[model samples]
Target: MSSIGGFLAAGLIGAYKYRTRGTMSTSVFLMQLRVAAQGTVVGCLTIGLAYSMAKEYLFDKAPKENAKSLTN
Candidate 1:
């Protein structure tokens, strides 16, 4: 969700910049989209990996009783 938001924001910003410059091209727009897509993929992957690591670490260190409490 956040990655999508970031991508949209980037694209919008890029478009705005191009419009302000009074010169817009398909190539430039496509380039912005490509960059946005790459950023979204990297951001999502990084977030997923970080969340997984943190979850595993927390669960591993949690007491059995405390872990059981989560099921309730």
Candidate 2:
């Protein structure tokens, strides 16, 4: 999913940039795309990590209704 999203993002960036300035060559375009894709993937991982940490933190702060076991 991340890979697909990255590729899509890269493709969009390539099209947009190419149409705007027309200065970037094929190799530069390819590199830009690869960087864009990598950046997207890294961004996703960072977001996921932050989300997990926030959830864990919230859960830790939450109060327990009862500590006793059901059999008790």
Of the candidates shown, which would achieve the greatest TM-score relative to the real structure? 2
lDDT of 1: 0.76
The C-alpha stretches of model 2 lying farther than 4 A from their native spots are 1-10, 19-21, 59-72
Q: List the residue pairs that clash in candidate 2.
A: none
Q: In candidate 1, what residue range of length 10 has the lowest lDDT sum?
A: 63-72
lDDT of each: 0.76, 0.78
Deviation in Å, model 2, residue 22 alpha carbon: 1.3
TM-score of 2: 0.55
Compose the digit string of candidate 2's lDDT tens values, residues 3-71: 787678767877887777577687887787678768877898999999999888866787777887779
Candidate 1 off by > 4 Å:
1-22, 62-72
